[model samples]
Target chain A: MVYYISFILIGIGIYGILTQKNLFKFLVSLTIIDTAINIFIISLGYIEGKDVPIYSKYTPVANFVDPLPQALVLTAIVIGVGTLALGASLLVRVYEKYETLEVEEIAVKEARK
Target chain B: MTIATIFVGILMIISAIYAIEAKKMLDSFISLSLLSLLSVFLFVIMKAPDVAITEASVGAGLTTAVLILALRRIGGDEE
Candidate 1:
């Protein structure tokens, strides 16, 4: 159920990326895509009734949910933030150079040059 | 748990759609942030506290701030 939703989110993001004219809109779509992927990975580790993978005196490893995906997603969240920041900064430079965030305009300017 | 997951999943998809289809860039950004928050709830329902915390802080918190700052610098509208 959630898996299919993740796929739908990815499709929406892709549609936005392909159709949007603004660079910042494109970046937002990219982040949405990244988020869908993250959700899919985290969902892959879910086990019904399993306790979180916190090691404690009463917690048994047998019933603990998978810890690996959580760790991976932790790293992924930070990486996603870094990627967003980088993309935003690059958009800033593009705006400075082209004086517009619209890709069609930039392409037109390039063609005239 | 399944019901909770489904609810959050639906919320996430709805917000993602809004994020992509909204007219204003700031509105789209806010929708994206809402999407992240829904995902955080989904993470918690999935029994991944670590991921939930990370997504809340980075996705809903810092990413929105960074995007907002960028929008402020460039101005939010495409025109």
Candidate 2:
């Protein structure tokens, strides 16, 4: 069920990336795509009847959930934020110079220059 | 519960669609945050607390800040 939903979200994000004209919308779509991939990774490592991977006094290592995906996702989330900030800053610069957020407009303006 | 997971999944799908399909830049931006929040809930349900915390703080908060700052600079015009 989770995989199905994640695939659907991935498809939606890809569609948005292909069709959206606004620069901000493109960034939003890319974020959505990254999120779907994150969910997919987290779901893949789920084990039935196991507790979270955090160590505890009584918790047996064998009963703990897989921790690798969680660690990867932690880094991925930080990278996602960093990339988002970088993209937004670039968009700000583009908007200042081109005076528009529409992708086609930016391309056309650049083509004419 | 499975029901709650399914519910959050549905919310994620809806939020994703809204974020991409909305007419205005602000609408899409706000919906993107909603999508991120829903994903956080989904992560909690899927037994990934660390990912949920990271997503909640970084995904929902910082991502929105970056987008909004850019939107303000760009004047939030989608056309």
Candidate 3:
């Protein structure tokens, strides 16, 4: 079920990437894809009836969920943020260069040059 | 727990679609933030408190700020 949701989100993001004309919308789509991938990765480690990976005196050690995916997702979240910041900065530069955020307008401006 | 997970997943999908389709750029931006918040809730429902915290702080908070700043810099007039 979670897998299906992520897949749908990925599809939506791709659709947005392909169809949206605005540069900012393009970045938003990319962010959506990043988030969906993170959800999918985290879902990979989930078990139906397991405790969180944290250990405590009362919790059995063997009952903990997989910790590796959580660790990987921590890195992924940071990377996603970095990617978003980079993309946003690039979009700002693109707007400055092209004088517009619309993809069609930018392409036409490029062709005239 | 399974039911709650499914519910949040559905909401996330809705917000993602709205984020893509909204006419106003700010509306799309808010929808994207809502999607991040729902993901945080879903993370908690999955029993991953640490991931939830990270996502809440970084994904929902920082990402929104970045997007807003970028939007402001670019001017929010969408045609």
Tens-digit per-residue lDDT, A4-109, candidate 3: 9889999999999999998888889999998898888888998888888887886856797788998989888988899899999998899889889888999999
For model 1, the superposed segments whose C-alpha errors exceed 4 Å read A57-62, B76-79
**Displacement of the residue B23 alpha carbon in candidate 2, Å:** 1.3
Report lDDT (Cα) of residue A37, candidate 2.
96
Give the alpha carbon lDDT tens digit for every residue of B4-78 in model 3: 878888899899999999998888988999998999887876678888898899877899999889988988756
How high is the lDDT of residue A84 in model 3? 92
Model 1 residue A17 CA deviation in Å:
1.1
Docking class of 1: high
The numbered model that scores best in TM-score is: 3
Ranking by TM-score: 3, 1, 2
Clashing pairs in 2: none
**Candidate 1, B-chain TM:** 0.90
Clashing pairs in 3: none
Give the better candidate number (2 or 3) by TM-score: 3
**Which pairs clash inside model 1?**
none
Q: Model 2: residues >4 Å from true position, as ranges?
A: A57-61, B76-79
Please, what are the lDDT tens digits per residue for candidate 2 over residues A1-113? 88988999999999999998887888999999999999999999888788888877767555777899999989989998988899999988987899887888889999999
lDDT by residue (B1-79, candidate 1, tens digit) is: 7787788888888889888888888898889999999888878888898889989998889999999998888765664
> Which lDDT values do the candidates have, in the order given?
0.87, 0.87, 0.88
